[model samples]
Target chain A: MIDAKHLTKTYGTKTAVDDLTFTVRPGQVTGFLGPNGAGKSTTMRMILGLDAPTSGTVTVAGQPYRDHPRPLQVVGALLEARAIHTSRTAYHHLLALATTHGIGAERVRQVLEQVGLTEVASKRAGGFSLGMGQRLGIATALLADPETLILDEPVNGLDPEGIRWIRDLLKGFAAEGRTVLVSSHLMSEMAVTAEHVLVLGRGRLLADLPMSELLAQAASDVVLVRTPGADELGKALAGIGATVSRTDVDALEVTGPSAGRIGDLARDLGISIHGLVPKQVSLEEAFMDMTRDDVEFHASAGSAA
Target chain B: MSALETQAGATVPAPRAAPAGPAGPARLAVRSHPVSTRRVLLSEWVKFRSLRSTAWTLLAAVVLMIGIGWLAGWGSNDSWAELSPQEQATFSPVDITLAGYYLAQLAVSVLGVLLVTGEYATGMVRATFAAVPRRLPVLWAKAALFAGVTFTLMLLAALLSFVGGQQLLGEHSATLGEAGSVRGIVGVACYLTVVGVLAVALGFLIRSTAGGVATMCGLLLVLPTLGLLLPSSWQEHVLPYLPSNAGAAFFSAAPSADSLSATAGAAVLGGWLLVTGVAAAVTLTRRDV
Candidate 1:
């Protein structure tokens, strides 16, 4: 389990992570969602003790990361940067890290094979393609067989097959009762893979909701109605606490009231209805709606096009 | 076995095998060892030897040590007949034997800087720190492994230079038994070891490659030359303490006027290194990676 309480990180006058308090429990994948520069990487760095938190404390299992006797064994983090030296072969790089914890060469070979990097183990990491490098990074993270895996944008440059491979790997890790935290700006991907999400916007927590809960709350399940006496029907629906959004001159999107109830009320009121359809809310719209107010950089070029 | 593919057989657990222990369920034991200084030292040795640059730099230092010393001895012997009476009377065979160290120290020390700074330049420090989050072991391991290798190898180069140089000197040659001869030879290797260690400390303090190399050059090379422009009275008090000038006293056949004795010079160089080391440790532990 990873726990961060009141964590804040600031660079000069700009705050990167502001007073974040959350717990990442084991047995599930927690998605860290944020736009670029929204503090996901900084928070991960703080947890790994790479960067000091400007204020507050973060711990893995219990104590800070530095206090762990076997840090690599406790947390395996694959940050955005490809941390391998470009000139060294993959075998040597893994061996160097393995030796630090008195880990044997056998474990190194196992991890290399585990990541499908055994074939290229002798090759210089500089020559590996983007997907290969990502695999190598994952191999290093698994070298110690860590209990908590924190991956930052693990699917950035992967093919569809590779993406599915990582998704299954993450699910497997979680099923093994390991804590898995995956960060990504890709909402569609996170919607499918993550069971719980911690969304950040402008360095502050915007939403800390379960995936199913968020999807259900964003679930449109709304009844749309068109009638000649729309004004009278709107007042009656409002009296029943159903939220009515005027979508057109004669149509309204009604929430809270079931289609059967709205139809019965309209018929009893003697108002003729032209259309009564329930609108389904897409997952993409739910994610966009949550972050719509949080996107710091407006896309001027895309808007222009 | 294919990567990530487990054998579903009865021979093995077919999944994560658990060690027999009470730490958790008789399942996934998560065998992991703690970081040890010895392991870090071994890891550093692996890093130090794997790079193409490490091989080339060590080779260059060895070649420079033997090549320049041999050339200096040969040149001195060839000019013996043309030397005036006073010049002949003042000639010292020991000086010619270790002359290559002046150039070789640059090569050895720059390699020291690269040993640590190269990781930073290539974004490998993150991987390094991620493995050992306490951070200082990485610095200490680099320094220990680097100093150990440099001292061992450079000492051999110095011995070779001395043997080859004395041969070139012919009748004018000095034996190791001669006054100040062994000191001149061994002192050059000792001085280079100190230089290499100081460069490693400077590398951790200044993470940038260009900056670390430039600072090393300024400390060992430029600052000493700049000392020449100092007023003569201040030069006697200040120049003798500069890293290069003090290191110069170590390999000299006799202590020059206005400079510290060889013992004092080594101590002064050691002092500079100690300060550099402490500063490096403090900065490394205090700063963010």
Candidate 2:
């Protein structure tokens, strides 16, 4: 488990991660979600003790990451920035890190195989493509078989196949009872993989909820009606606390009411409908629906937004 | 993709293997071992040896040392006939054997600085600090490993240069058994090694290649040249105390009256290194990556 209590990091006049308090539990994959410049990397760095937090603390498994007997063994982190010397071969790079915790060369080879990097184990990392580099980073993270895993955008540069592989690997690691915290800006992928999500907006915790609850929150029935006289129909059907938005010149979208009610209201109003279709809210829309209010809330409070 | 063929779950993947439960794999220990100093030292050594830059840089240092020493010896012997009796009398074979340091120190110092600052340039410092969160052990291990490697290689180079240059000098050659000959060879190695360690310290303190190298030059090279602008009395008192000059005193068999003694030279260099080392440790520990 990883616990961060009031973690804050400020750079000069800017606060990167401000008052972030959350606990990432074990035996599940916890997704760290945020927009660009939301301080996901800064928070992860503080967790690993690379960057000192301006205030508060982060601890993995009860103590600070630095206090662990074998830090890598306790938590393995794949930070966003590449932390490697380009000149060294992939194998030697892992070996160098492994040796630090008294881990042997044998473990290095195994991780190389696990990450599908054994083919280029002896090649200089400088020549590796972005996908290959991500694999190498993942291999480095798993070298010690740490109990907790923190990955930042682990699929950022991976190909379709590689992305699928990492998705499974993370799931498998979490299944084995490791604390897995992976950060990403995309909500679609997290909808498929994450059990619980901790979302941030402007360095503050916006949402900490289970994935099912998040999806259900965004699952209210919203129907679309395509008609030429959208203003009259919108005015007629928008009563009773329902919201009607004109998506196109002739299309009006209705929410906060059932499709049958909207059809009956449209029929009673004598508004001939060319198309009345129920729209399924996608994960991406759900994400935008959830964060749009959070963003507006910040904008209304802070002048900088 | 093969990975997508067996879908575990829409929200969370199912367990592909049995629960790890602290007995994950054979390689993973049930309880973790502490990060010992010995392992950190080993890690540092592995890092030092893994790079091709290490090999090339060391080769450059050796080449410069042997080439300069031989060239200096050869040029002196070739011009002996044209020199006056006074000029010939002042020529010291031991000095000629150690003359390579003027160029060799540059290569050694650059490598030392790169050993630390390269991590910052490549973003590897995060990985390093994460592995050893205490941080100081890493700095110590790197400095120790670098200094030890430099000293060993430089000592061998100095000895080779002396033996080879002496053979070329013929009648003007000084044997290892001769007075000050062995001391000069060893002293040159010590001076170069200390310069390297000092460069590593400066690298950590500065944390940038351009800044580290510029500061090193300002201290070791430019400071000595700037000293010439002072009065002769002050120059004698001050120039010999500069890092490069003080180190030179340790190897100069025929020292000028104003120059410091060998022991004093070592002490001054030691003092400088000690201050820089502490400053480096402090800056590294306190600063954010």
Residue-level lDDT of model 1, residues A48-115, one tens digit each, is 99999999999999999999989999999899648889899989999999889888788888877666
lDDT of 1 by residue, B1-289 (tens): 2123212111211112222223345344445688877878888988887899899999999999999989888988888999998878878888777888888888987899999888888778988999899998888899888888888988899899989999999998889899988888778888899999999999999988789889988888898889889999888988899988798798888556777888899999999999999999999998888
- i-RMS, every candidate? 7.6, 7.4
Query: Judged by TM-score, which candidate is best?
Result: 2
lDDT, candidate 2, residue A161? 66
TM-score of decoy 1 = 0.88
Q: RMSD of candidate 1 to the true fold?
A: 5.4
Lowest lDDT block of 10, candidate 2 chain B: B6-15
lDDT of 1: 0.85
lDDT score at residue A117, model 1, on the 0-100 scale: 68
Model 1 TM-score (B-chain only): 0.88
Q: What is the C-alpha lDDT profile of model 2 across A9-48, one tens digit per residue?
A: 9999888888999999988899998777778888999999
What are the per-residue Cα lDDT tens digits for candidate 2 across B126-148? 88888889899988988889889
Q: List the residue pairs that clash in candidate 2.
A: none
Chain A TM-score, each candidate:
0.85, 0.89
